[model samples]
Target: MTGPVVVGVDGSSACMAAAWWAAREAVDRHAPLHLVHSWTSQPLDVPISQDAHSERLYGREVLRRTEAELLHRHGDLAVTTDLVAAPAAQALLARGGDAELLVLGSRGHGSVAGFLLGSTALRVVGLTRCPAVVVRADDPTVGAGRDRLVAADRDEVVVGVPEPGPAAEALLEFAFATADAHGDLLRAVTVVPGSPGPRAEEERRAWLAAELAPWREKYPKVTVAERVAVGPAAQLLLTSCGRSRLLIVGRRPHPSHLVWKLGPVAHAAVRHAACPVAVVPHG
Candidate 1:
């Protein structure tokens, strides 16, 4: 990872917030920091295209200047810039490959996701190569509200099948840490595909209880619940994730799998969860 903090920037106020947070994080982690920006080529020969194209170029230049200033401000830190020809989420995931962690502004350049957890953040959180931190948009004074971290990282025991794969472990660890640190409630949630058969629901419920039982010592106060309903994971989770301090999920084993990439549960959590969502890498 070259021991550097990697942050994705889109020249948005949110991105800058992420960059600022990343600077502090790099200092804390004693690692270098890199600021990344992305832009695609505009349509060929269109009116005002020059202005639009030039704007991204300016953004890149500004990023360079800021990178230098950040390094200068931090006595022993290093900062660099990356310009890429991909979407913000894709670039961040790729860049995250060489980072201890990835920092992101909870909100994106445009289109807020209920709060700042818009689609980009959601997609990237579960897919990033490393654990991701979504800096809250409000930046409310630390130790605000419930001041709790909800850990929802775990395999969704599929009745007879194991929780998707090894990915759940990373997610659970992030959740456990946050909960332990923030003194927040650790709400472990899993979705069970809707089954009309009462027998199937009963079996799934039993399995969830047993799975969560072993983690009691780890989370003395974690509340466990399962939603056995129809529809995709994302929609169900979005509807159920109420007041969670941080909705946690893990990277599925097969990052390239289309279903895992756009899983209903993870997508919904990223898109609509009120609080920040942490995408934990495979621990």
Candidate 2:
């Protein structure tokens, strides 16, 4: 919470949606908002309909309009803009390093308009130490969470706990804090080994209960539902998220290579879930 909430902005409606979501989050956290747009110029003398200059101009316009709109929406919120001449991933990673949260918009398949969750978002989310939230551009519940952050209509926050390890600490803390902030129900789901014997099932349940007991006591006001599912981790999580407004998952920051970024379940949730996904990085 020390640094401002930063959002990556391109001209795409998806980035706009991300900016709006980031703005609301900034307001909620009482942090400043930074809008970043990164671009690299085309080769000099390249023949094109819309050249680098035009693209730069358009980027500038995007920033201006987005800044204005955010200000209009939240007059008292501190909003700033930047147009960087760099790759989107590098710019976002650098900016997000010192940010409270980094928000980016995801477009599936890149067929329709809007910024797709191309390499840039995936890279930034994978490498950044800060918490990142990927908001789908086509999400129907676009600004609903912002409208009622404390009391959203669908007030269930679902988090997937893969196993008993130190990595889960950050993810669980984020889930609990989010649920507490919104005064929502917290649903923690863990996938037990399929067809476990009764003793193993009891042990798994006990471990889960013990794992969450500290958080439960700390957040006494938070209503929690602990679910132990036996199936493929991703499928069970996706099914459990039917009534959830937000899905929280954890990913370790791996080498910048594409293959090392998201774990299987987190990747699946980010790719297929209808709700927004908050990917918390844990070492």
Candidate 3:
């Protein structure tokens, strides 16, 4: 069994939505749910007596009440809570490495430029060893049967292919697992990193064909379809999101160090995808 599903909750409306989202995922995966909250020990710039330690204590109480309320409301779910001693962002990043999925609520806490580029979401997006799902307070709907590449039949699972790396296994595993569960086809998609050179591209396609053979045969319920295109990963993914019920992606490495930064394509898709996206780590 996997570790608990993690969600950052602060009692806000957006946080509530994030909790609901995480809860649904936890139920689907048959995993425990972990609701986390954090606060700093520093005092406010104003002449405030509330130090960071006091604030954390208050935060802990709030978390306790919140968890109790959640458990009561979702009696059927197995819910747990954690009150940690770090800022929300840092604590989330630290815990993200162990959880199956990390989710956050967007309260417009970052800059306008950052929001346009999805910056605040990018912070943990790159660093997390698991996929992080960010839900906007204003977002009214969540999508399902959403695929980046979906088959025509109803019983097909859609898998997303971000830049292949440590997390490639997540997409492959999710696709097959879903197929195995529902007796559906498994669709895989990869955004061509720019238009490929003809010969080089052909070689990659051959490689992909070879890679798929074992999977298709092993999971006979998993029929396969592939999509390759160029432009941006996020945009392509968003397009794919329109077609499939679920999208699978790799966990972002770290935001600051990578050239492409936080896997913008994955970021855009997760924030805006029509279907629920599972950002799984390769492990």
Top-lDDT structure, candidate number: 2
Per-residue error at 239 for model 1, in Å? 4.0
Give lDDT tens digits, candidate 1, residues 189-257.
555655646786677667656665656567776444445554555555555545554566555545362
Best by TM-score: 2
Native-to-model Cα distance after best TM-score fit, residue 91 in candidate 3, in Å: 1.7
For every model shown, the clashing-pair count is 7, 0, 13
lDDT of all the models against the reference?
Answer: 0.56, 0.75, 0.60
Better of 1 and 3 by lDDT: 3
Residue 282's lDDT in candidate 2? 82
Ranking by TM-score: 2, 3, 1
| Candidate 1 TM-score, true structure as reference | 0.56
Superior by TM-score: candidate 1 or candidate 3? 3
Score residue 129 of candidate 2 by CA lDDT: 78
User: Against the hidden reference, what TM-scores do the models get?
Assistant: 0.56, 0.86, 0.68
Q: How do the residues 1-283 of candidate 2 rate in per-residue lDDT, one tens digit apiece?
A: 4699888777676777777777877886678999887656222122334477777876788789889988877999998888988877777778877888888877643321233245556766677778888877666446532363222466788998867786678888888887887678999998777577778778788888998999998889889999986778888888887667678988876655454467888778878887778889887
Q: How many angstroms is residue 63 displaced in model 1 relative to the true structure, after the best TM-score fit?
A: 4.2
Question: In terms of TM-score, how similar is model 2 to the real structure?
Answer: 0.86
